[model samples]
Target chain A: MEKVILIKYGEIYLKGKNRKFFEKTLENNIKNALNEFNCVVSRIPGRYEVSGFDPKFSSKILSAVGKIAGVFSFSLASVVDSELEQIENISIVETEDLDGTFKVVTNRADKTFLKSSMEISRHIGGLILSKNKSLSVDIHEPEHILNIDVRENKKTYVYVSSNDHKGIGGMPVCSSGHGLILLSGGIDSPVAFFMMNKRGVKLHAIHFHSFPYTSNLAKEKVLDLAKILAPFNGGEIGVYLCNVAKVQEAVHENCNPDYMITILRRAMFKIAERLSKDKNYSMIVTGENLGQVASQTIESMTVVENVVESTPILRPLVAFDKTEIIDIARRIDTFETSIKPFEDCCTVFLPDSPVTKPRLEKVVFEEAKIDLEKIIDEAYAGIERIIIKS
Target chain B: MIYLDNAATTQCLDGVVDVMNNYLKHDYFNASSVYAPAVKVRRDVENARNELLDMVFASNHKLLFVSCATEANNTIFESATLRSGDKIIVSAGEHPSVFECAKQFQNNGVEVCVVDLLPSGEIDEEDFARKMDRRVKLVSVMMVSNETGAVNNIKRICKIAKKVNPRVLVATDGVQAFGKIDVCVDDLGVDFFVMSAHKIHGPKGIGALVYRKDIHISPLLWGGGQENGLRSGTENVAGIMGFFEAAKLSMKNQKSNFEKVQKIRDEFIDEFQNSGVKFSVNGNGSPFILSLSFDGIRGEVLLHALEEHEILVSTGSACSSKHSDNRILSAMGKSQAEVLGNVRISFNAHDAYDVKNIVKIFASTIEKLKG
Candidate 1:
């Protein structure tokens, strides 16, 4: 009566020579997710089976499996010996209370078995029909499909995959590269972190906080967002909180009022670029969308991003609409935390009329009134680094 | 730390903890259970109830011990059976517990009217008298404004409302006025008086709703017939005993504590005047609390600035600090800047901190933030 979890992966089977690399990353990621539980993940030829866990933790393990990238689907299954009688009994137990149309699916990897795959399915189908008079066989589109996976390990796993057990199908995290994500306590940035993480880019976060102008609750809100996005990034996200109040104050006092957002964004990007270089992250990620605000326009993006000379700026939601980004935010459970209305650094000294399109030289001239290097260095020296785990 | 946010909550007095432990450890019996110890516990709870009622000089009223002031306020409205087209009046400067309840009543087809507040944060008695009518079933006004410490003349208010419509029931939220000033519910002529324990150095999670005996109030919670069928569930024995101890101490030293707190408030104002920082007093009423406004500085920023030096204060009432807009300040005819720049510095009778050190911190922090 041992129960296990059966995990199936997609897209990785299409990977060419680096298939093992993806599989290993996915295996390590899943292991990290279920590290708190007492279980073992064993490879079973084109699938992975998690066993030796307490029965009470079966649902928890399946939930963790459901959050993992590169997984197509998973099931809570009962493991039995390869004998037909044992398989028949477990299949009956699986469909004991279930009624309606069902089809028995069998994959016989054990060649020594007497019956073929179709023969096993037909035999189990007839036996199940006789036992439950409420059920009939529907091979085309069955309400329930009882999958009996007979592996080469001399064990057969009988499991049922409910409609809610589908996995988040994407590339395995950390398989692509590492990124430094500019996370803000807003609706867009956390969703951007999720998008980059789904594409196999592991992320560390950086948030700019204005303390006296904003409160401690604003910083806590950003930390909560990081905690929510950590599970997709292998259960941990390193966040660096920079107090940019001094820089913002300098900009507010010295820079042109119309170019306030542009100069402030330039300063943030400069700090982000420096941090990414020091931390050895490959790229910088943001939740910037096209024409969303005055700071997200084509000219604004050009002027703001020009400060980073070496790193590539990745805007995953550049072409997305506001509603589309919000949908992803709601799905990832960061929408509630993001909409907390706590003021962040961006809202501290918002200009009444910020320039949407500015000349590069004028922007540079306005940014030079304040000692950008000195202020950014002072802000950078006071980084409060925290590691948030889900 | 110089904790000046006493109006939000005060630290539990030392003796209150011991009193609470006595009930929690030794006399831990369910008051409803049929046993000797349970009977003793029930009698102790009743004795505590009687002692609390006596503290307010409310011999003609009965007190129901509930969870907190918020629940007590809600129960006042819940106990009253008001139909559609019936009217209620609440002061514009009420606490959210009362203000939100008024809004809920208005949404449910009752005609809810709001009385105005003067710039001094006192209730406009003329406006209150004008709003009084036979259709108005209930009138809720706080004895002390939580944001500014402005004491409304509840005795005068009750007299005027009763003259207009003697059938009207009047409830006064006395959370800030309970221990800070002399409170005689009989003298005030209020049908319902709500008070909390935590604001007066007592234990939290316990409050009382003292109502006149002649009035009929239905139970909000229906259960095992506790609180004589007014409120349900087992009595909070430890909380009751702790509250009684705190209330006893506060009542015994009311006169001396009031003089000390008044002197401390005067010292704060005199020292600020000498510092030449240019600040305005928001309102004048109770000596236990003081609200100040600076011309260009944000109160929250000043609060954080002082917080770095281990001085804790509040921008407004702690419950409404999370909200950026100040409804009470706005209703008092203050400009948006004045509302945003207002900070409340409240005093506890038991505070032993030096006024000079706190004023020095305030001056230095304001200087730094002004840059």
Candidate 2:
């Protein structure tokens, strides 16, 4: 008895003229994914064949391939000679316990074979019926349909309906580029990070923490956020933690409470823009929702935007409501960590009656009171780069 | 430094900020109130709505503002599928909001058919035709491909869909394409068109769904009858104002900005090609999105490497970034290596100068990797 595995390409079939390139790439990817199986993988026309593996590892290999990006669906099929007698014999033996309504669906690629598709189906169908008296053929509605395929390699493969799980078949990562996510240990930011990542954006994270003002728990929450984001980002997060506590504290001490958030936002933008410039980030992604909070007000947003010389800020959750943002955060497993009662630098000096609608002129006036450049420099000085390995 | 990911979200325009500031300071009143401040708020709301109508080129379309695109999408799905056993057909690739909402009908025994996509990421005509039958109560597709930047032939698809099932409502998730592209619901002939303010440089927490007057949809949220009873909640007046301004600006600069970004995209592609790097573009759908697949290096690795140089790109869609699945690239038949190596370099009109620098960085990084 020869054991064979049938592999199917998911999104590769849609590649049209460039199908072969993708197929080859998928083949290589499958081999790499199944490297531990010690199996021989061979491309056989429409499908690839995996043989000579420890039967014990066959399911594992298939499971791994199922997780591979380019693979659509796969199955372990029984490979037999193209001869009708052999196929019939195998079908009879395989369906010995079958007591349900069954039909044979056959695909004959070898035209030279004497039997037609319908005739083969009838013959195979009759053989199964003869083996089990309780089984009846229902052409339109069969309880189980045995699928048989004949290939040009002078081989026929038959399989039962068992293993067909959907693959997350999209374009591979690095097929796009990288995105720098402004990760706050808040619900909205991580959800925003996940949303952008779903579209195939490789992610690097920027975290703002005030060391003395905010606890290490805040940093730990962010690190946990990174770890949660790591699997999707290929197992690591490049975190740039800027301690804006001092600068924020300075703004709180010097500026009016209403202007504190606006000034602090400007400083954040300065740091984000500088980091974006240094990182060549195409855009800065934030978790800000419009009108969700005082700082996210259009007026405050403008003040923050004015500080950044370049780098478009990507606020994926900008238009999302609190409930929607929280829903996604919960879905992405970030809600628990985000709700851990850790106050970030942005929250430490938060005024009780923070201005909902801060005037741009007032913000500018308060901003003028502080040496913005020096504050930015101090914030940059407090920057810490940490690599999180998940 | 240049910011190019405007289609993702835009900075708040100065005028929008001023308007919001004035409203927040002196006229902060709930629109539902009949009192002096409330009357002022109501007038402002009406003014903003009218302004938005003019901005999007939809003066007559019924506009219902929601929290965001996701809520708008959910509203359409929940409302349109009120009839039992109604079928819905959605494009294979839509924003998660639209796609996930369409999947909800499946649980309700409402037949859901996801139309196939062409290699260019457009809706497959044959597949669309095949999926369109009497059972299909509504057909929803996106105005643009968020991942590939592929602008869907909404006008054509809508035409075909209406031809097949005149009763079928046509909805488009215009989140990515609204401001970036010329979005006139009347011109596109879509029964429902959704737009998110944040995508167009407006504030977040505000989006609108424009429903054709003839089409009726149920309200997803039940609250104070705001947004013509289609959406009920405290209106996000500031966000809406910002959205209107952003929409207006995007409309005003659409052509020039598109051309500018096209030039940058061309330069980046040309430079990458000239550098002799083992790279391939994932989708030939739209110039707004450029997905490049590099050999050997994983996207995360290159992402961090480029981060070291202050270059930010994306691996795929930002939504699925945290998940190990690269559905778009994988759907494009990208291998693990290729999928892992994929990065998206999206640009807006303001991104003209960034491309040149990006080209240089891309060349140097590829060279470094090769060395």
Backbone clashes (count) for model 1: 0
Proportion of the native interface contacts kept in model 1: 0.00
- What is the model-wide C-alpha lDDT for candidate 1? 0.88
Compare the candidates by TM-score and give the number of the best one. 1
User: What's the distance in Å from true for residue B12, model 2?
Assistant: 2.5
Candidate 1, residues B42-160: lDDT per residue as tens digits? 76887798789877878467799999999989988986677789999999999999999988988889999999999999999999989999888899999999999999999899988
Candidate 1's C-alpha runs over 4 A off are: A110-112, B1-371
Local accuracy of candidate 2 as per-residue lDDT tens digits, B294-353: 987777677767777877666666766666667766655567887877777777664336
Worst 10 residues of 2 chain B by lDDT: B1-10
| TM-score against truth, every candidate | 0.54, 0.48
At residue B195, what lDDT does model 1 achieve?
A: 92
Model 1, A1-390: lDDT tens digits are: 788888888989999999999999999999999898889998877788898886545655665776677888888889899999999999898887677799989999899988999999999989999999888989999988989989888899897645227788888899889999999899999999988888889999999988888876677778778877888888999999999999779888988888878888888999999999999999999999999999999999998989999999999999999999999897777886798767888888898999999889999888878898998999899998999987
